[model samples]
Target chain A: MQKDSFRVRAADLLDIPADIKGGLLHIEITGKREVFIENHKGILELSENEVTLNAGKETVRVLGQRLRVLAMNNNEIRLSGIIESVGFVREGSSCSQL
Target chain B: MQSAVNFVRGSVLLEVKSSYPERFFNLCARHGIEFWDMTNDGLGVFRIRMTVKNFKRIRPVARKAMCRVHIVKRCGLPFFLNRFRKRAALISGCAVFCIIAWIFTSFVWVIDIDGYAELDTARLLNELSKQGLRVGTYAPSVEMENLKNNILIDMPELSYISVNINGSHAHVTARKRTLPPEILPSELPCDIISDKDGIIHDITVKSGTPEVVRGETVTRGQILASGYVTGRAGTTITTHADAEIRARVWRKKSARMPKKYSEKVYTGREKDLYTILLFDNRIKLYINSGISYTKCDKIIKRTDLRLFGRYRLPISLERATCREYEISKASVSDETAYDSLSKGLMSSLELPEDAEVINADFITSSDEVFAYATLTAESIEPIGTKREILRNG
Candidate 1:
């Protein structure tokens, strides 16, 4: 209830409050893949069949895809297997173009 | 909770009272502690639990509220051990007294065998001696549990054996094993007959053969029974209706207060105690401390016994009793007299509901200070019919 220090991270699904001041983000690897990070910032959500990300704008979705968000500072996301791919997008990536 | 149990634990509990419960709760919250049993007894007596740990912290608060902060007067072994001023002389005196008392108590001064039915005194004592429970034996050395077990083992006949020590004596009470006294040793050739005037409910022949079957009509003494009837075989006899019956019987007793039976009441106080040596009245262990008030009556019983049957010494047991005082002359109307009579009758005769009180007699003259009544009750019991058969028959 107190706005004092709270953090939440999730795998397989990302249900973030869209109106949280800094907005929300999610990244994925195409092989049900693995994402390694040197450092990270926001959250990276991983799941089978799809990769979705929210970076202050629209959600990025890539199905039959493997992807990784690079240098996101202190936070990490990973998914590994099938099609084995990776990617990152800024504000306004289309969910319909997966 | 009672803290005055005189237990070995050093912990003392207090039942403190405080009006401002909120303040009390805040105090406990401020300090890492809690108060249980939060109850308000009228104005001031608020019952709350407190440990010895926080007594110092709350003492000032208790004083401020004039709260009766009772650390529930702990008479614990530690408190008693710590309470009194440390004096070497007193301690030594107590030690010496304890040693003397220890010695005194160590020696079994009196012994009584209670609850004896068939067990002989000599047999019990002999059995008790085997269990290290004889008179003049060291009380401190006597392991009561071990002694009980040992006695039980030695006399397997005793149902229960308890050894209790009060003051300087050991009370050895045991229940003697009782079975139906040697049952008429093998039933003689006897007969089954109606015990009551009513039709027999059922008949069972344990040893003898039966003659009366179920649903057989029979009268009292008109034996639907037989012992010497001719059987199917020429010389053989029919089922003998004989019974050397065993029955449980009890007797009811009735006694009227025939002549103002005496009643006793303890005045709650009695004196005249002297240190008597080994139950010997003549051999006083200590001189009687001078005091007044000797209108009381006391009953003293003495028993002498030896240690391991080596040397015997009598144990003096004095049951001091206050003398029963006689009533003074009272103004009485007819109603009060009748009430007194009824009370007296109720006390004397405890009758059953079916029992009819056929008579209530007042047997007192004008000169008599007390009045009494006699009650006659009617009851029923089966009278046994024993025919002393002539040997010729």
Candidate 2:
């Protein structure tokens, strides 16, 4: 935890993206239709209505209707189809809220 | 666009039935197996598309995930070609057709000649054939500059020539040499002579002395205007004679038509013969039985097969239509024969456009086998013609 905090502070002080320095997931959402996640760990759970992914420190859950994995590779996961909301569940946190 | 890439690379659609499908997805992602269009069917069944190479690598992933992967559909070029592997004849036919098409397109099929006026097309084509530029000649072997030069040297009448070969068609354009106009000696002493025996009605001499006055009778070859002109000092100077002499000319023309004539009467009976032309060889499609009609007309229509309405193919279809007819004797009425003969005689007269006809009389006569009409007419027309005066050196 100390090492992660020092890395975040260094990234902020040096004006660098934390995702690049701290290995954080970089998620980009486009108009509630598509969500592209870079620096992903793997898919945790997948279904038609929702998708959950392991993003190193947090579990990212995508809630949508007829959600699908458009494309997936080691570092990237692209989800499409009527995305409703995205909530992040940190370690030991309940799945109720972000 | 990605689908096109997948199709070219050969992809397979797989249906995964597993208790834990998310593990299968994560295993595929961890193994760097790119997949797309993933969907869930709600009964623990999911569908996804992956490349053929990745599908081969998915056996370990499927085993690790405890998933049974079934190929729902196989798509792309390899699968499509494998489906036709059993039909050997069809594949060979397609191969042969492509080979034949390639071979046919390598040679010239059509030769288009343009810009030819007064020059005979057949003669030009014959000349071109002699120089190895005719139809069916290999297009790449044609040396255009040498061919043009050879043809120009062989036929001096062609001033400019260009040969352009586009695919199986060769377009040859040529311009004919324009001959210079004839140069006449205007300084030569000449006389205006009467070309026909006529009574002089008017005479206008431009550069010579008038030899005949109005109402004077002149015969053919008689000089109407003399080339010798008396100058103001009474000195005789020879000059070219130019004059327009209008005179009353008499002409007679006669035409005869046979009273009995043979006319062609169609019997309404016809027969069709078909032929197939493959390149230069003609194959008769119809059986060769002797023609039944004694007198018939054979009309042949040839249709050339083409590709895309532009590329001419060597194969063609020919249909010969034979129409039977019989000859029947027919006689013309006296009045009809007289009218026909009179029209023929008038057309045969070959009167000038500006001539004015003063009087005309037609005499009709009939013989045992023929009817005749004679036309006698008097017209006022220009009768002067130039005749050069030959002087001894």
Candidate 3:
């Protein structure tokens, strides 16, 4: 047995987050086209930075220059970083200005 | 991974300066508070991780006058999180070790027979096999005590037995039991008899009646004289003699010298070399080549497995080899045949010193594998001494 050398990266108990349930998690970027994902699973697929999620009976697309979904669930979703705003792109609906 | 609590699991006493320390101590004891340093040292503090469930009860005790209730930063969540992984890891590690230990202990790969004497080794092994301590047996399944008892019972001459297992080796030690001495106990009075018939040289009587006289030629078992003395002219005669006569007897031995035996025999000259093996390859098996000459009977063989535990199963190797042999024996010459005849006669003939070789008449001679001949010698030797027993009414 050797000593563990993994440095503890402390975070505020409240700041640490979780989504205990299964769902699609995405990080999107408007200007950046390339995204890297080390691991993915389920009915999930991705290309570029945009993420299309059909979960909880909702087709949601969060468009931004850079975005990340830290965790997600059927009832609640956790997001991080600043966002410009949120809008939906439906089959019949188009992107509208706020 | 080990628990932090265990290293610090021993007690560190705590003494309190708070008013009514006795009450607090009692209350703590009542509430089963299991922490702290005991000696009083200016409002002693105890750091402990109490569950949220029990935290409420302690709140009232700490909230009393001159008491301040504060929950120090507890590191419980991560401790348990790490614990679940660590204990599982430890148990699984131990499980794997136990399996390997069991596997090594299960088989009796090497069997050792620790004791035996002039008893036949092969026969002992065959007997041991009947008792189930053979070479290729599994140790765990062997009932050693039962096996030992069975062996002792079956072979009464084996006094003690011990069976021990070390790793894959099963060792059996035994002691041979010796039988008691034999005695011929029946008392039947058969007349004393001489082993050989000879001319009477001397005689003495001890008991019973003597049946032969001095200067008489006595056949085998003929008593030479009487131990019972007859009283003459009012003299009382004793029925015993102090000593027996000594005699010298002639003994002879004769054997025909063989030119050669009909059966073929192996020559003492032999050679053998072995191959070395490691794993499956022959690295260096033997340190030296034994001998070079092979006679009529030759044997050549190689076996890698049985003697080496890892390479081969428990069976030895044997192989017959080809040999170059002489086609025929040269016919013995007359002079050579006579010399061989004398050599053979001298070796085989045994006679008393007084005995003489009146003549060595060679009957016949033949030379094939060897010259064969026979000899006849005559000799003189002394014989006949008797100790006779006499019966008195």
Top-TM-score structure, candidate number = 2
Which tens-of-lDDT digit does each residue in B344-371 have in candidate 3? 7766666545544444555555545444
Note the Cα lDDT for every prediction shown. Answer: 0.48, 0.89, 0.48
State each model's TM-score restricted to chain B.
0.33, 0.73, 0.41
Mind giving the per-residue lDDT tens digits that candidate 1 earns over B1-393? 344431544444555555543344334434544343344343434454444455557765555545556666553466667755677788889889988866775677667777775777788878777877666677777888887887778777888988886645667788877666543223233344554333233455543445555544444564434344455675744333444322222222333222334444445565545444444345544465443544446555444445567444464434333343443334554445555655655566544344334334444333244433433332232222332222355
Put down candidate 2 lDDT per residue, B193-286, tens digits, no spaces.
9889999999989999999999999999999999999999999888999888899999998889999999999999999998999767899997
All candidates: TM-score: 0.30, 0.74, 0.36
If the candidates were sorted by their TM-score against the true structure, best first, what order would they fall in?
Answer: 2, 3, 1
Worst 10 contiguous positions by lDDT, candidate 3 chain A: A38-47
Model 2 residue runs over 4 Å out of place are: A1-27, A56-59, A87-98, B112-119, B159-167, B171-253, B268-278, B282-294, B306-312, B317-324, B342-365, B374-393
User: Candidate 3 at residue B299, lDDT?
Assistant: 60
What's the true lDDT of residue B283 in model 2? Answer: 95
Error of 2 at B296 (Å): 3.7
B164 in model 1: Cα distance from truth in Å? 14
